[model samples]
Target chain A: MIISIVGAGALGKTYGGLLAQQHEVHYLMRSEYAQVKREGGFTLVFPPPQNSMQIEAPLLHQDAKTLPPSDLVIISTKTTANHELGALLGHCIKENTLVLVIQNGIGNEEWISQLVPHNPLICGVSSMKATRLENNTVEIAYIAELRLAPFQAATEKQCEIIEQAFAATSPAIPVKAYQSYKEIRWRKLIWNVPFSALSIIYQQDTQVLATRQPYVSIVRALMNEVADIAKADGVTISQEHMAKMLEATQKSGPYYPSMYFDSIQGKPIEKEYIIDNVLALARQYHIETPMLNLIQTNLN
Target chain B: MIISIVGAGALGKTYGGLLAQQHEVHYLMRSEYAQVKREGGFTLVFPPPQNSMQIEAPLLHQDAKTLPPSDLVIISTKTTANHELGALLGHCIKENTLVLVIQNGIGNEEWISQLVPHNPLICGVSSMKATRLENNTVEIAYIAELRLAPFQAATEKQCEIIEQAFAATSPAIPVKAYQSYKEIRWRKLIWNVPFSALSIIYQQDTQVLATRQPYVSIVRALMNEVADIAKADGVTISQEHMAKMLEATQKSGPYYPSMYFDSIQGKPIEKEYIIDNVLALARQYHIETPMLNLIQTNLN
Candidate 1:
């Protein structure tokens, strides 16, 4: 199976490197193209007990137009760059190719659906913690499940095929499929919207956000706001589920979310996908999200 | 009249310097004492058209216990230092002294009232923009009206005398006395709560908060919340007043509020008086202030 990973940042490189172990994986690169090509491939670093390996350079396409069409295209770009998706995906995917958006926040699937209307879109959120140490050097702190859901024309068979592809990797990247894409996305937001946003705002990590006093309360309020917005959008996220998410984050050991790193590096964040999208839905549903609204202001 | 400026910060120095031109003014000093004593005065820089002046060392006392009691004691300390007011004022004021609490935010008068129970407490908010340049130098950008209101047993006669003392200064510090302290505090909060708190958070000035989108809306939302809390607390802060406050702030030309500077200097902010007190009132009234609550979390 041929798989193409677009916008190969930290997550993109990690997932693409893993898939390259099992199948032919092509990385569409931009800034890191020269170094990655010079390095001959990505050096995948796994935590202790799990052996690390290097992926010898496969087909590294700097331009999307030069890349061959593949069975699956993973859109792991920071959703801030979703603007370039139409041109990138248009030049890379075939007529029934499955496009998996393993990105944070809401509106990615809708944006991709609009960008590449005919493709089968699979939207998923990865719990795996990965960081790009340098160009073509990907460090994996953990490999967790990639929860996937079919959006629009995505079928069960395609989902299963994608699941199997991940499962066959050197260290299996667990995959779970849900019936409702909205549920999974909002569930992810239950963590992402508050911790990701607040981590950047407070210049602190998940441990502080989850365990601190007023911050803990603010996180809860933000989660409640996200849940209310999700409910209004036809997705019900239970209080127990939100509590579990907070509990997991409290024990996540001062982890900085992708958005925090983006802010630290002075790069544009996925504020549009993660926060603005939720705000738009909240506005559409006439739900007042004052905390979310305040967070939105700070993002700018 | 003998005027004792309790906290000789930027505003304290400016006001004290102005009053020293006419009335006998004494400055109770702390951190700036040694430098001020060495210089033998405070250099007050007035905006052009008004010449800057040097206030030769009046009775600059480091120990409040050693200071002589005054007819009027102007409390211009950051509300964060309200803890020290009891000891400081206990040593510096006479039983019937007119204690003018020229500070920011709510609860200041209440706090001072408890501290020096028998004094005629005049609670006020100054619109003057003053910044401490050096140990004994204060640069005055603009000196606007000092809006005062009697807290508990402060008499109209005492308010008039205080107003006249300010009026008799070389360049008059205009003072307006309102009937209700709560009304004046809340009215001031329509500007202080949002601009002061957010300026610190964004590390930007009032101009950005006032002119920027989403932020402008946020400022409005915060103002509305403050007004709601004010209304619940029996103070009527009209929309027109809030709009005027925002408009004034927009034209204030990138001014950094005192809180912003305090944050930059790593000093504690007036979060308790400015935000937490309002939140407490909000909780008491059962009014939802999501923005204020979130701001409170960030202050910690």
Candidate 2:
């Protein structure tokens, strides 16, 4: 099996390492493009590693043109870089190869659907938390069995093969799948809309947002917008269940969302993916989203 | 005429210096009790002090017991520290002394009234921003002219004499007699609740709060709460007029409110005085103040 990763960030390296155990893995990193292959491979510090989660130094390549196509081409780039990387993978991907997008926020499915249409494209809702310690040391903060589902309603045998591919990596890494991935993704969307926007607005963590009413109000309102979008898109989220998720946010203690981490690094934010998509969809579906509109304007 | 000073912080020192020009002044400062006398006489550095602005350093005493009946006494302490100082002034004050509390926040007139009943008191509002430089120099940030009204609605020549005494020294500190000091106090109350709460909440200045949406919403909500309290208390506040005040918040850019300054020092905040007062009054008057309640709870 050949697994080509479209991102070189924390989640990209982690999943690539997991799949690399049984497959020939490749990475498309931003910095040190040449050094990745010069050093023989990329290193990812995983959870089990001592003092660091240094993952396997799998076969790495920056250019999509040089990669061998096989089992799957996973787009694990940040939401901001998804489209550009989608184009990069579009040029090299073969007809039979499936595409899986595992990134934060919405619109990754739409971005890759344009490139991977008619092929199996999996939408992943990853609960695992990860951070990159320097370039190659990708620290997996927490691991949770991922829920995988088809981007479209087509639950074909190809999707089952994709699940089996993830299962095969379990011996050397950890991977799992769920049939109810649509529900799970919508739930995760609920968390993302609130946490990411509130963190960016207050320049604080979930804990701080939970404690401050203005941030909490803003977070709740934005989450309602996402949940509204989800329902309008045919996924139901009850208010009581939503309140439970808000309660769970306090358990993360003081976790900074990935978008906030991006902000601290002075990197270009995924405002277009996180905020822009929800707002555009809300407009399309005629959803009332004053709170989301305010957040969207703020992001701009 | 001898003037006794209480709570010798910035405003206390500024007004103490202003009144000391024509009268023998006694400032009761805590800490360094001996140094107040040993410095020969305290020094007030009023840079570019002209246009009727004056500075005078008179006989200083640390304990309130060193004071006899004076023509006037000004309270210029941080609102959080007022409880202790108010009790101290209650125990060692002559009935004939006119104690004018030139401070921020509402409930000061009532707070002092409980301490010294039947005593002539002047309630004042001074928009003088002060910053203590290296514990030696206190620079006046601004003086939008000071206003003085009777603590209670009184027609005696007493208010005029107190204003005249202050004007004789500073010569430019205007003291307007309001038919009701509560109206003037509530108007000043508008300046504080939003600026202090928003600035302290975001840990930023007026300009930053005015510019951002999250902050802008929080500030607008807080202003609406204050305006409601003012209206319930018999003061009319138009929506357009209230909006202008928020715009002026940016105009008063970069100035750190006293509450924000106190938060920086880890001192107890006057969250109780500003927001809490508005909220309590609202509750008493049956005016709904959801935003003020949120800010008050967060601050506490």
Candidate 3:
């Protein structure tokens, strides 16, 4: 399958580099046009070669304007950058391009659906700890199960092809196809909301964060609240899974979450996106949410 | 009045040296039997003498084994060393000795009472931050209220005499006699449980701890839980007072709490005493105290 992975920086280059090894992977670059149009295409440092995957100028284009429409368009960009990625996807997408959004934060699926209304939108939450080391490299420090939540009712053959494309590029990374995607998305949302948002609010390392009694308690309370909202929204999320989410965060402590990175960079925070989403949902359900509410209010 | 002050620390010496100018003040040292004994008398450094108090030794002895029993024994030992002080208090008291506990932490009433079981015990809490300089000099940091919880409903004249003793020594400090001592102790207990314990737990400076969302939340939750326990125990702890308790700790940022001092020294942490008291009370009331229980289980 001809795969044009859009917005190729860190996560973009991550998916692009890995998939490119076994398939035709086209990397859509941003404004640094001349730098990429020459040589040294998406420099990826994959495992074995994984420490750094330096793709020596694999068929690179500067923008969607330069690229041909493809079968699968994996939009791997920042949640804030999703709209631009979506607009580009709309311009270059074939009639039935499976746009799998492998990004953090909430509402990327709906964000793309609104822009490219005809494109099949699937929101997949990736738990890979990938840190970008300049444009030339990204380190995939850790890998967890990657889930592609069901968006529209697509064919089994289409699903297989999409899965195969991702699998071929990164065979080690599992892409589970969820029949009920909201359940998985919200479950993933439960983990992201507290860990990412709280990490930003405290401006502390994740390892030190786990040791703080208050932060841990708040995280647990927020997860419980998220579970309540999920149950109210008719999504089945178990307590054991909630505990697992916290445990996963504990294991991922040495690695900084994206929200914390965003905070340090003085960029616009995701307080409104991650926490506000759950709070808005809680309000819709008329749930009492002082814990999550206060955490929301304190986010910068 | 023939006044003998034990524990010749800052506050002890401050009051002792002041009263020596007018009334009888004896600086009861633990051991002067081995040398360094002088009848030069306790020198109270003053605004009169280059701004330093040099109190000559009045009376020096080690424990109950030495010295004659006096009318009153003013105990000013550190609360962490309260057990040892309590043992000394038991060994040295005369028939009519009145012991005033000038220390922090909850259960001072019963704690000291357990050691010196039949003596007239005055459970008092002080907000005076005292720092002892060289020799006998001391600096008073803040002038806050001092509450003396009634030992056994002393007569008006007895109360007046105790008041007069304090007035003669420290004119700047105000001592309030509380009809109910448990209420006052619980109020102070609320402050230490969250801020001090958290300071030790997080090893964070006051400014970061004061406003950090999780720290503040843990603090508020601990206060709220303690307040609920107080309510269940029929203590009139208001939300207004609760806010004030938090405000005081938050305002005093960058200050190393005494508990933090104890933690660094590898001494027995005081959360077992301060917070443990509240959690026990909560257990009695069947109160749902997630925060206190969480903190208690952590450091222990």
Candidate 4:
């Protein structure tokens, strides 16, 4: 299957590199384009005893205008650049093309669906944690299943195909298909909103946020707020789910969320996508999310 | 009057230096003690256009036990070290000595009153901004009124004497004497709680907080919370007062609150006295202060 990965940053590179091993994967690059092209390809550094592999001379395209339409187009850019998606995906999205938005926060799938109205849209929430070390070097810190939910014209069969493609890779990337888009997004937010926001605010990692005294309480409060907002927005997030999210984060070792990295690197955060959207939903549902409001204020 | 300024930090040094010009002022030092003693005395650097003055060879003591019982004992330390006050002020605080706590936050005067029950205690909220360049060098950024309120056994006449002493200095630090301690502390918190807390959380100074978009809104929300908590605690803070606090902060140019400086310098912030105390009061009154709670959580 022909696949294209847009905004080839850490996550983009990691997933794109894996997919490139078995499928025709084309990388649409921006800042790292010249260096990646000069280096001929990129390297994927796996955690633990897993050997690092060089993804030699994968198909790289600087402009989406030049890239051909593929069966799948993975949008993995920082949501801060989601504005550029219209022009970036205009040329690559066909009627049957599966547009997978594997990014943090909510509202990206909706935004993408509006742009490519006829294309099948898929919302992806990845527990897979990765970071770009250098221009052409990407490191995978943790590998977990990427949860997929069909949005717009996307069918369950389309999600299955995408899962099978990932499963065909040398090191199979785990994929889980969920029925409800809102449920999966809200579930991901249960972890993302608190850990991502608090990590940046407190300048701590996920483990500290999950295990520390006031931080742990704060994390729970923030999660409860998210759950309340989610429920108001037609999704019921249980106490067990919140507990599981906290437990997973606690066992994930010390890991900095993407937003934390964005803040430290002086890059614009995914505040609008992750936080502002949640706040908007809270307002829409008339849900009182003081903790979430507080996060929004701090981020602003 | 023989006055002793404890915790000879920027505020301690600046006020102590000014008072030393007329009164027999002794500074009780800790980290800066050796260097201050070695240098003979500290230098007070005024804002531009004013000549810097060398406060030459002022009486300095390391151990409070060695110092004479003071007529007035000024506690200007970070409230994080307030625990050490029992030991630090034990020898210097006489039965009639006026113990003035010239520090940020709410609980310092209360704590000091508990420590030296018979001694006249004064709560001071200074708009004067200063920074210690070195062990023996303190710079005055903005000179404003020092608001004073009687905490325990403090007479109106005692406040006047303190005010008059400040007036006698070459560069007189303005002083305002208020009748109610709670009212004055809450009034100060209208500015301190928001600016100080937000300054640390957002990593921005007063001007940014006062002038910026969502930050300006946040500042107002936080101020409202403080006002609500104060009102519940029997102190009525007017809207005009909150506006005035914000306006003053906006006009103060760019100023980092003491708490902000403490945060950046890796010193323990005045969180206990400034925020936690306020939170405790809010809880006591059953006042909901989401913004304040948020600030407390971030600080933790």
Question: All models: lDDT?
Answer: 0.85, 0.70, 0.67, 0.85
B256-298 in candidate 1: lDDT tens per residue? 8888888898988888888989999999998877567567776
Pairs with backbone N, CA or C atoms under 3 Å apart (clashes), candidate 1: none
Candidate 3 DockQ vs. native: 0.02
The segments of candidate 3 whose C-alpha lies over 4 angstroms from its true place after superposition are A31-39, A48-52, A153-156, A170-172, B1-220, B224-300
lDDT of 4 by residue, A1-300 (tens): 788898888888888888887788888998888898888988999987788989898788888897788889999888999998889998777768888999889888878788889888999998887877855678887688999999998899999998998898868889999999998899889889998998888788899889876578778878888898899878898999788878977887998888998899899999998999998988898876656766776776
Off by over 4 Å in 1: B1-300
Candidate 1 vs candidate 3, TM-score winner: 1
Superposing every Cα of model 1 onto the true structure, what RMSD results?
13.4
lDDT of 2 by residue, B211-242 (tens): 66656766776777788789888887778976
**Which runs in model 2 stand beyond 4 Å of their true positions?**
A1-300, B32-38, B45-57, B153-156
lDDT of 1 by residue, A72-100 (tens): 89998888888988888866789888899
**Model 3 Cα lDDT, one tens digit per residue, A9-73:** 67777777777777777877775446766656656555563455567777677668767787778
Name the candidate, 2 or 4, with the larger TM-score value: 4
Tell me which residue pairs clash in candidate 2. A44-A54, A44-A55, A45-A53, A45-A54, A45-A55, A46-A53, A46-A54
**Candidate 3 lDDT (Cα, 0 to 1):** 0.67
lDDT of 4 by residue, B1-300 (tens): 999998888898899889987899988888888887888887999987777999888788888887689999999988899998899987887779988998878877878887898988888888777888854678887688999988889899999999999999878888999998888888888888888888888788899899875578778878888888899888998999778878877887887887888899898998898899998988898876645766777777
DockQ of each: 0.07, 0.03, 0.02, 0.08
Model 3: per-residue Cα lDDT over B1-300, one tens digit each: 556676766667666666666666555565332332544543444333235555565555555555356666677766656667645664457766677777666665667767666667777777666665444346666656777776643333455566776665544456677777777777877776777776776687655666666567667788888888878877778889888766766678567767787789787666645777677778889887655655664556
